[model samples]
Target: MSDHELRKAAHDLDVTVWVGKGGIDPVVDEASDQLKERDLIKVKFLRAARAGTSVEALTEELAERTNATVIETRGNTGVLHR
Candidate 1:
């Protein structure tokens, strides 16, 4: 899909995965699983997870770890797709 279409689709998606103090390590499997079950999944990076990191950094890392692509990062939330 095009970037515009993906962004529009992501607008209605709720955050299905949350990265907290435990960070991306714990959510890697869960996010990957969610992606396998659906075309798109949204993730929120809480303040604890963002300590010394930016949302773009965290989401990019998570996407790499989960073998997904970051559709976008808005505020502390990110949309991911495989």
Candidate 2:
């Protein structure tokens, strides 16, 4: 789907994965698995997860590990698509 369409779709998606103090390591597997079952998934980065990183950076890292693309990021939430 187009970026715009993906963003629109993501607007209504509830966050299916969350990153907290454990950071991306703990959620990488889950994110990859979710991508296998769905075209897109929403992830929320809790404050603890963003202490030293920007959401964009964290999103890119997670997407790389999961073989997904970043649809968009708003505040602390990001949408990923495979």
Quick one: best lDDT, which candidate? Answer: 2
lDDT of each: 0.94, 0.96
Candidate 1 lDDT over residue span 1-82, tens digit each = 9878988999999999999999999999999999999989999999999999999999999999988999999999999989
Q: Model 2, range 10-31, lDDT digits (tens) per residue? A: 9999999999999999999999
RMSD each, Å:
0.6, 0.6
Model 2 RMSD in angstroms: 0.6
70: Cα error in model 1, Å: 0.8
Superposed model 1: Cα runs more than 4 Å off: none
